[model samples]
Target: METVSGHRPTIIDVAKRAGVSKSTAARALAGASNISDSAREQVLRAADALGYTRNALAVGMRSGRSGMLGLVLPDIANPFWGEVARGAQDRAADADTSILIFSSNRCARKELMHLSTLMRARVDGAIINSVADSLDDLDRFGLPCILIGSSAERFPDTCSVGSDIVQGVGLGMDYLRSMGHERPALIVGQPTRLARARFLRVVHEHCVEHDIDPAVLLIENADYTVEGGRFAMQRLLARNHGLLCVFAANDLMALGAMSAVREAGLRCPEDVSILGFDGIQAGAFAWPGLTTIEKPARQIGAQAVAWLLDGNADAKPGTRVHLPCRLIERGSLANLCDASARRVGSVKG
Candidate 1:
């Protein structure tokens, strides 16, 4: 079991040390179902003792798998997506697979290009976040693909994972209404984004069910960026100064809206209340901690990787998994139902 000079211990070394054949060592290390428990234990102990590591490239070549997964995101700069990437990376590492990440910058052409590049690279599978509207081209990629943060209905044959945007929006609206803010406006993301459409639809349905005034149900489209959020908030304020509360689709936009509120000589939770989505870490440190519907971005990312690794083997085509969102109460929202001096404080600058 002695290794050659300057050479790494190989499967042969593990086999000789464990008194098993090379094939047996490989099967034991791979945790193949056919390997006996006693033999597998012996091989594992010998490999640990000899410090033997299987060459992943060689293993992939034999198995016809690259042992790599691809992840495509709309914007890596967004902290929400950063958390997703972290989760995916951790999960991939656990399975002894590497990940190649591509940021599409929310461009359809770039997304397609990235997918093609991944295909050429021979990635075993892929997980796409916010896939483009039309998925006809994705069908030919010849890879096991999973979609995140987008509707499964749009891509019926692909496995999809994401938060229930409609439910998340409803939760935000109900919380705002409970706080006595009946006239709340929504700062939405681009119309091309599926989450945006789902959020708006749910908001409108909630309004209809509650008989809310149509005039107070204001909606403005943003680019899902901090700057975009600020611009959308400015527009909403200019159009309607009477809005007591505002909800932004994501935390970045919500933070931007808070900046705009301050520039307008208004105080959050005092002159106006603010609510946000995505539950990013930065939101917790905002001047008045942001009230938000917390989407488990990391968990979603991890689960997406798991689904891809499992190859959706037993699941039917077009399996959709929707993670629940929770409402996190923070300093940014004010209760309008409170009739004390604070209630007046909430209305005045």
Candidate 2:
């Protein structure tokens, strides 16, 4: 049956075209087991011919279960977040759902606004990577929500999915120690972020375990951008001339710090070694390449989707999932132990 003018094609139209009852066409389109193979094929073929498609929104409204998710991120421009968003989108597609993404740009008001919009849109659940605690709004709305990254730890009793920052920092520190780099400085996020304190704690613990006093260590904050990293590196350089290596909170900052080292008439790995976190692809192609701690960013995104949509009660709220991280060795870090051995041999000769 041809669709009437100014009207969208529906299952009725498909049924008329396929010479079947409306109920039979619906069951055939829905892949119901009761539908015969001949009827199913006819319904599918008729739907194709009439350009008929199921209205998921109508179906969801009638069933009171829309398969839509909301994802809110601090900065979508960052490559790390890009990978996370990609993973989430892919996973949502697999689950026959859609994701509505919003970038809050680390603004609390913006985050609230986006959350409100998601609620108004009737999304089933939300995945939020926040800058501040967002639990109160959650209680008010009574919607299922999950937090990602540092803010998740701050708010107890919320489901969160994130990579292990502690393990990542530990890998960087241990590798630095093995390379014989003692005076390692830190380029971290601003003090407002819970992540800054988290990184500081890990580095301080590492130094204490290695018998190095934490007070003497250099620590500066950056905006997780290249320019921010450059400025932070300049400040750290001004305070210390014997900087052997610097570990940045992310790869972009590390790349910027590397440029700052060169601007100071020094060479990477020769004068100042740099280590980065967040194992982005650009780190592999950087000049002298960047040694970084690889976070499972994609897994973080996908896992959040999985847990959010889980109908089972096993993944309870306030459950925090911390995935592991590892080190990616590259040329940015100098092997001072090897250089020291060569220096000793030359002096003896």
Candidate 3:
């Protein structure tokens, strides 16, 4: 067939070539299940042959949906967040929808700006893992939204999907105690951050349960980064805190602390044992495999999108979902009961 004179190919051109009505071509192209598979395939083949392209804007206008969702993340560069984004993208693709991802770079202003942009783009909903944004900011986003990560607990009356931090904290504390590390040093963020505060609270509770004195517990405030952990470890070493076991807030900090131990002319699990949270893949391949409580990175992302797209009745405002975390035992932590114990580890370590 010769090209249509003086015009681009349209659904009519495709329908004519496929020997089907225009409405049938439209339904087939839209992936309407009412059409038979054979008909859909035929229309698709004709459209491909004719080089037909969908005007997504027009389609969205007709359907009153943009077929896109917004994802606002604090830091996209982090590997944990990357896994979450991948999970969300995968789930969105399942529903024939796309995701518009924006990184706030841990800035409240930037997060609010991204939300505004998402609104301007007419996204169906948003999934936010904000760092500095307040609950008011989320309310101002004025869209169906689901909070992600530990901070979700800080905001009341909202739908959220996050890892069970309390469960994870207990798991970490229990494992450390089981390893015979009672006075393990804690490396975490400032006391104000809800996640860190929550973690510390659980640690205190665990101490009480195990008949340990919480006041003598070693603690070092660190950023959630390798450099931060390194500096914090260095500071703790300076104090001569007799570090035996150190548990960091995340894998990055734990990895950093490991390097610090070496710099101080000490050996890991020999002079000091280290435990980390966040079972990032790098922990598995570290020099000493790091035992950690693995956060549900991908699950939270997928579940958030699922709740948003599925419109489940129970996924109402104020609904909070906490997926469980698991412990990945590796070589980083030392077993004090072992015959080869290098040193007698104590609680104040």
Model 3 misplacement above 4 A? 1-9, 33-39, 312-315, 344-349
Question: What C-alpha lDDT values do all the predictions have?
Answer: 0.85, 0.83, 0.84
Per-residue lDDT tens digits of candidate 3, residues 72-116? 998887778888998999999999889999999878889888989
Model 3 clash pairs are 158-318, 183-347, 243-349, 244-349
Q: How many clashes in candidate 3?
A: 4
Model 1 segments more than 4 A misplaced: 1-25, 32-52, 313-315, 344-349
Q: Identify the runs in model 2 with alpha carbons over 4 angstroms from their true place.
A: 1-6, 31-34, 312-315, 340-349
Given candidate 3, what's the lDDT at residue 183?
80
User: Cα miss at 139, model 1 (Å)?
Assistant: 2.1
* Native-to-model Cα distance after best TM-score fit, residue 9 in candidate 2, in Å: 1.7
Following a full C-alpha superposition, what root-mean-square deviation does model 1 have from the true structure?
Answer: 3.3
Q: Per-residue CA lDDT of candidate 2, range 1-349, in tens?
A: 3476768888888899999999999889766899889989999999999989888677667767667988999999888888888889999999988999999999888988898888877778888887655567655655688888788877777888999888888988888889877658889999887888999999999999989999887888889898999998888778755545788999889999998987887778777788999999889998889999999989988998888889411358578889999899998887867845321111000
Candidate whose lDDT is highest: 1
